[model samples]
Target: MDFCWSPTDPVIALFVPTDADEMQPARVSLIHVPNKEELKKKNLNGVRDCKMFWQSNGEYLAVLFNQFNGTRSTNYQRFAIFGIKDPGIPLEDFELENENDMIIAFSWEPKGQRFAVIHALDQRQNVSFYSVIKSHNRFQFSKLVTLEVEQAGSLHWSPAGRFILVAAMRGCGGDLIFYDVDALATLAIERFVATNIEWSPTGRYVATIRTLSDELDVRQEEFQEGVMIWSFFGVLLYQIPRRHFTQFWWRPRPSPSSCTQEMQDVLEVVNELDIDLDNDLDNVIFFGDVDNEDTSFHIIYRATFHLESTRGLGSVVDRDWTYDE
Candidate 1:
């Protein structure tokens, strides 16, 4: 079973796969939260797996189904779009021109009317873009463009939209491509053995992470575990090597108006100190207070003296201080 919540509405979508032994068909349902009502329910046959995607505005929901051909022993893909806000919650079914092509990745453009899919056939992969168009009070899906990509298996869209990062990860050789949707141009192409890709909340930076597992052989050079930070245009900003690195997360930032006075004061002090934690170690001078009783008083005195020294009243204070009791 899998479920997803609508970003902008009080709706939740649920999917339960069919059980061959129990003789049950796959099911999908949308539930309205506040009123505890069932909005829509759909049953499907021959489905092996289902994935659900909600548009940024919660206006529509896309369901991708992977189905198997029992006779051919092959798998194919189909997708359905549901107009959540429309009357009766209408749904439209769609499939690729080649039914045998398997979809490897899918993404909805942030706050936009389009989505992209990476589909593969016999090892050759291509990324296709589609737009959801509304005409005559009905919604339609239109294919925009399809581009052949080298081992591309995943898509990461910028938070603010317009840019996308196409990457080939794990067994796919770790190739990276940054593309501009509006200009139909490739911004930068690079390589990294990334197992995961993330875009900064502000859409200004991207982080390609390579995490290693014990089950995989780590003797290969490409299996190095670390994180690489890149600019929106794929410029390499910083690369930090971490042993056994498994996870990465971005810190959330609050708006300027939400800043408290204490927070602003801390920022001012940090800026004034101008400490370079990574490179200023050589200039650090340590003052140690060994007596337990006078430690606090000495710390205050030393801090005051250090601040005065910065103004030419005494010698310059070191960036570090040590206290012992």
Candidate 2:
């Protein structure tokens, strides 16, 4: 065992890095939160490595493991899914049939119905998708796509099982490949692509971090910041400036275009409402660039609202002076 938990599974996780036999066997384990009694089993997957395991569903315990198929890891660099359910009890897995090495990187579907895996094939990249069948107790290998030397890169499935976004960095700069999973074989490609992609929570937008450096003139390092907000159909909505690492809304509710009147006629009135908890004059807002060099500076946008004390100013004074009503 090249890996063991430092404290316990409760504190830090333990990894084997490589199996005793395969050295690195594309390992993955799921600790499906089980009943307190059922959680104590150590040999369910022919391994007692996990601190606790539970059933993600009625039939599966989600696992994360360190196993390499001898393709990527010096010790164990590959990860996989193992079903810790019935008959075989432990190590009972739905292995990738007729494959030498398991894919180095993979992602599970949001709904947990499917997962996507890309593997090493013929000195090339091949992406394979697996659909989870709960009733049948198996993972159905559904779709497969193969690519050349540098094609099959930056592949990500949408949050739902709608489509997959892939970037192929082959001959030219690169390409964004969109494959509609529902349409079947309908592929759309966007030229000049980059990586580190994220689809918006609403599933309408995609964000990717890309370096805009020159490929040939690598020494001419002209680094700038940018963020591209793209639509589902690959339209450039806007490439916002990355000032202070700005964030763009990937998916906003679709609405009619904004008009000039739609912009709020922001009414700002500044008056001293002297209920001064901490010199409530501080609550008085100045709208313009009224920079007081002594105490205040501009960039104070506006004062919207304030809370007032119920006590009258005269009574709150608590002084010896008497006033006639």
Model 2 earns a TM-score of 0.50
Q: Over 4 Å off in model 2, which ranges?
A: 1-98, 135-140, 143-149, 168-173, 193-195, 211-224, 241-325
Question: What are the lDDT scores of the predictions, listed in order?
Answer: 0.74, 0.41
In angstroms, how far off is 272's CA in candidate 1? 11
| Worst lDDT 10-window in candidate 2 | 264-273
- 180, model 1: CA deviation in Å? 0.8
lDDT tens digits, residue span 179-257, model 2: 6655545456676444357676555656654444444222223333445656556666555334223222221223236
At residue 140, give the lDDT of candidate 1: 84
Candidate 1 lDDT, 1-325, residue by residue in tens: 8999999988999898889673988889999997879999888777867999888888889999877666637767898889888888888887887888888888899889888899988878898888888866688888877888877878899988889999987654756989888777889988656778878777778888878854443355657676787888989877656666666555345677998886686455545665442233211111222222344345435533444354332322332322211
Model 2 alpha-carbon miss at residue 77, Å: 8.4
Instruction: Give per-model TM-scores.
Output: 0.74, 0.50
